[model samples]
Target: MVFGANSIAFFMFAGVVARLLIMWPIGETSLKTWLFVHVFRPLFGSLNGSLLFALSFLVLSYIFMYWLYRKRIFWKV
Candidate 1:
């Protein structure tokens, strides 16, 4: 179920909530803009740009998955 959360309905929920909670306050001019920009821009503020910040997080998730696999670990529940 690792990828189950990314189905269309889930993204719709996330999109709406992200627009309200994040994009609204950050002075984003439009919801047509990417949602991750609002959610990640602050934490990644010093990363120079969204692409680098996103790539860094992607790498981090992959490393974490590999580490877990090496330990024969996976999530349950």
Candidate 2:
């Protein structure tokens, strides 16, 4: 039972990471528009209208989820 629950959580995390990767390489403008304006802008100093090889959502999501995984964090309903 414990193994099953762990496996489900593992796969759920994998799926979320995969979805993020598939939707990556988002435009700078799109990020600015969709995400919070003050969040990353202050932290990263903006994308400067970069297009090619820009900061991707996939990379960010993987970093975030990997950190959570390392911390043994999980969300339950």
Please provide, for model 2 over 1-77, each residue's C-alpha lDDT reduced to its tens digit, 9 standing for 90 to 100: 33233455646765776566455645644433434344555555556423312445445545665666677766556
Highest lDDT against the true fold, candidate: 2
Candidate with best TM-score: 1
Model 1, residue 43: displacement in angstroms? 17
Candidate 2 regions with alpha-carbon error over 4 angstroms = 1-55
The TM-score values for the models, in the order shown, are 0.37, 0.33
Per-structure clash totals for the candidates: 0, 0
- Candidate 1 lDDT score at position 9: 36
Candidate 1's residue-wise lDDT over 1-77, tens digit each?
Answer: 32243334334444565456444543546442444565556556645556765575556545555555566554444
List lDDT for all candidates, in order. 0.50, 0.51
Positional deviation of residue 2's Cα in model 1 after best superposition, in angstroms:
9.9
RMSD of 1: 8.4
Task: Quote the lDDT for 36 in model 2.
Answer: 35
Question: Candidate 1, 45: how far from true, in Å?
Answer: 12
